[model samples]
Target chain A: MDISPDESIFLHIGPVALNATIVYTWITMAVILAISWLGTRKLTSESKMSRWQNLLEVLILGMKNQIRSISHQEPDKFLPFIGTLFLFIAVSIIMSIIPVYQPPTGSLSTTAALAICVFVAVPVYGIAKHGIIGYLKYYLKPTPFMLPFNVLGEISRTIALAVRLFGNVMSGSIIVAILLSIAPLFFPILMQALGLLTGLIQAYIFAILSVVYIASATRVHEEKEQKFEENRKGKE
Target chain B: MLINWFTVFAQIFNFLLLVFLLKHFLYGRIISAMNVREEKIASRLQEAEQKMMDAEHERDLYFQKNKENDERCAGLFASANLEAEAQKKELIENARRQVDEMKKRWNESLREERDVFLSNLRKRAEKQIYIILGKIFSDLSNTKLEQNIVETFLGKIKSLDHTERNHIKVILKESYNKAVISSTYEIPVEQQHIITAEIGDAVGETVEIRYINSQDHICGIEFKVKNYRIGWNVDDYVKFLEREVNKTLEEELAG
Candidate 1:
């Protein structure tokens, strides 16, 4: 059995290949896009709205509130990146209830891609808030001798983010598959239900971690500005 | 083997594309709609508060106007009551004045009537006394009261004082020595001679005497020479009795 969806190549075109991970990722993207389009086609400012509209608003607002809480900032700037991560991962995992469907998050390549995006987003947000020199100054906090360790910690945490999501999703499916062979009737359904819950938790964890990383990088400027104001008031 | 480099790059591009599409479609529309709804609710609340303030102001104005109207009505009522009281007092005063005037006129009329009645009674009593004295003298002495009155008038002429006798002589001289002797009854030629002689002796003049019969005398005689007069009549006694009766009536009315 192919342990990763990336191993199951669907097509080969010259130098390129189409695999289950890519196909499932596209499917998840299509499903999310289609639901978003259907829910937001005729948005209203009125109190009365359709149940579908209500559900979409609840979902978007919930995501915005979560980002705001974690980042300690306005959610508008970070909503697109963080909200997309949550929706894509959640939809991909929830679709695993199908018999022949493979979740894209079950593959290490997709998780690694998401973690790399978060890893890259952290520096991009940090550099945008402060200058390149100011963002790099965060590494030499307390001492310059810890700079190498801070850099290794950053790379190692990114790898851990990818592996943590991949391990959970992959192990849940694998366990369900093994349990199906042992007791195919009730246990698989129970395990699949548990998998769904675990999958949603993973999605939440992944999105929250990304927000925390981005917030840490961006918040340094705010902290410095606050400290500067406090020091100025002390002098006065 | 589990990491596919090509697929990771593809997923990254797909995820970024999906984020752009969703930002354009879902979040933008929903947040804009919510903001518009919030602004509408806030404006409606502001409008409601303004209307409530306007209503309260109008109510206060109405209460003030009602209070003013009540005060004006009370003032008018008090003034009207005072005016009515004044009119009532004036009317009572007018009625009392009218009553007093009527009473004065009525009392004056009663006095006039009493005076007229007393005069009529005096006249009647004089006539009655004259008749009674004539009858009594005729029955007692068997002589006429006119004869007696003529004798008494002659005696009064003879008993006159010197000053009164001179006053009569002067008046007779000024009157061309003409003297008039009037009586209720015609005197006999003998009594006329005696009366003429007595008056002539008293005045020391030979006076021309004219005799006149007058019904105004009540069994009495009168002699006149110009403005001077000598008379004796029962009418004087009747007038004195009438004055006494009037005085007694006034005293009884006062009591």
Candidate 2:
């Protein structure tokens, strides 16, 4: 059984290659965009909303709440990025129940790309909130000697975020393929259901970890003080 | 291991595009619509509150006007009552005065009517008494009473004073000694001759006498000369009695 959707190449265009993972990612994007456009096409503030619009609004509001709680910042600024991560990962995993469909999130490349986006967004938000000089100054906090460790932590956390999502989704896919080879039908369906659960958990972990990193970077001074107090408490 | 660098780059690009599209199509429009609904609700509430305040103010004004009208009505009623009371008293007093005036006029009319009745009674009584006295005297007029009256008359003539005799003599002289004798009853011829002789002696003159039977003297006798008159009859006593009775009646009425 193929472990990654990238193995099923549908086309080749010079140095860049078209694969199942790319095709499925495009489908997910198309579906998400089409639903968003259709649901909000005839919005009326004065009257009742359609059921689909109601659902969409509920999802947006719940995500905004979660973002605000986790980030302790304005949810609007990060909602699009964080909400997209959750929706894309969840849709891909749930869509794996289809007989011929393979989830793009089961590939290392897609997960790495998502983690890289989060890694990049953290510094961007930190720079926007507390100028470049103030944001860069956090690495030398408590002492200048802690800068390398802080740098290593940033790199390690980003790698961990990508690997963690990739490992969970890839393992589930691998398990389902092995089961389908062994039992052929019923166990593969069960594994797919289990994969749906794993996908949702990975999405939550990835989104929360991203929020934590962004929060730390944005409120450097406040976090530094909290960390200092914690260290003092630990010594006591 | 199947890691496609191109697919990763494409996926990142697709994710960014999705975020941009959803933000534009859904989140921004939905949040704006919610804000608009909130604004409309707030404005409607404010307008309702303003209307309530205006209604309350109008109600208070109406209440004040009603109170003033009630007070004015009460004042008017009280004034009307007082005026009505005063008019009632005036009407009563006028009626009482009219009644009193009527009573006084009635009493005066009654007194006048009583006086008129009493005067009529007294006049009738006097007339009756005169008639009765005349009848009594007429019933008592026998020949002897006539002779006695003639004798009394002759005695009275003979007992005349010197002045009276001189007056009679002057009257006789002025009359040329012509005389007439009038009687209520006819005297006998002898008595007439005697009364003529006596009267001649009293007068000291030769006088001619003409006797007449007249009844106007009411049972008395009257004599007439041309300018002097002398006679004796019951009518003089009857006139004297009537005068005395009238005087007594007048005195009693005055007392």
Candidate 3:
């Protein structure tokens, strides 16, 4: 149950090890706070914020517009969870740089907890917009024969979202750690930069996929499918 | 580096609290402010349009009142002209009447004066004729049969139609006038004189018996008739009066 971050020789306390991860975590949090503040300081509908501001705003606006495009209901209502998911994944992966540091996202347990939170919130919002009875109906697929398969598909897809982010971030951190130890100098910086790219990509995918999943659970995806089916029937 | 369950849970709680505060305070206020701004701009535009319409109405009222005033002035001018035309006609009528009345009065006065003048001339002629008769009788006194018999004899000679009987009366009674009355008996050239003189060329009466001058009293007198000087005496005087009387009569009749 105990973990040592980045395989560094570290001093130990009762349950935790104070290693390079601790120091890098603080730096990463500072970066996130400063960047998020700058993004919100001047908000205009038409213009773009700069640098880290642009990165954070893109994360927020991308998720917002995506949720809105899918659900057609109040997408901004989900901006808080979506913004948190985006920041957490990105900051964890970016912390792979400091010596003896590790990304928290590589842990399945962490990804699973986030996925459970999303699962719980989706039903809550659905029950709020549409009553409890309306929320349960979404589990039964439009064709009764497809019900069992559709339910299994929904649960499997959520599990897939969590596992995918966990495996990719963990593999990237371990590979780069192995490569840095082998090459010892120039290659480690190259591997570190690659790790950063992998980190940002994983973060964007995780946040985007989470919004789409919530959008589906609220019957937003089902409604779109119903219309598409009708259009096919009309054309035929 | 490693999992911290308590810290992870605490972080989640903080994130939820942050979202709740933002939703209630910031988002709600910003949206409502935008709505209020929209309403204020709309109201200001509405007020501006209303004021412009009011200005147009005022201009229409002003022009209408001005048109009414101009019509009133024209009406007054027309009334004054009508009054002046009436007065001008009245003056012309009065002038024509006055001219006619003045002409009538002038003509009447002139006719009366002419009548009086002619009557006075006739009376003077009659008096001169009597004076001539007395003078003839006195001159025939040596063979006088009284003046009444001479007048009766002259009257009888005038009633005769032939010159022979008139001549006989003239010779026997010795009438003052011995000229023949017949057309064949021309006037004796000796009894007529062409006196080309004013009063300074006058001579007195002449004696018929001697065919000579008698009285040297009246001035610029000529003895035109030999039997009884018929010059500026009674007969000449009476003849002049007769001609003047005739001219006056002609003027009165013509007028």
Best by TM-score: 1
What fraction of the genuine interface contacts, i.e. the true contacts, does candidate 1 reproduce? 0.84
lDDT of 2 at B221: 58
Best by lDDT: 1
For model 3 the local lDDT of residue A134 reads 69
- Using Cα atoms, each model's DockQ against the true complex is 0.67, 0.48, 0.05
TM-score of each: 0.70, 0.62, 0.45
Query: How accurate locally is residue B171 in candidate 3, as Cα lDDT from 0 to 100?
Result: 47
Query: Which stretches of model 3 miss by more than 4 angstroms?
Result: A1-63, A95-101, A143-147, A221-236, B1-255
The candidate, 2 or 3, that scores higher on DockQ is 2
- Candidate ranking (lDDT, best to worst): 1, 2, 3
Residue-level lDDT tens digits of model 3 in A139-197 = 66566777788778767876887678777877777776688668878887887788789
lDDT of 1 by residue, A1-236 (tens): 78999999899999899999998888898899888878877778888877777888899889999999888999988998999999999999999999899999999999999999999999999988888988888888647999999899889999999999999999999999999999989999999999999999999999999999899989856697578779999999
Q: Note the chain A TM-score of all models in turn.
A: 0.94, 0.91, 0.71
Q: Lowest summed lDDT over 10 consecutive residues: which window, candidate 2 chain A?
A: A43-52
lDDT of 2 by residue, B1-255 (tens): 566787788878877787787778767876677667678778878888988998999999999999999999999999999999999999999999999899888767855775675556545554565466556656777435567657777888789888888887788788787788888678889999998898889879878888888765655555576656666654555556556765775676457
Report how far off residue A164 is in candidate 1 (Å).
2.8
Among all candidates shown, the one with the greatest DockQ: 1
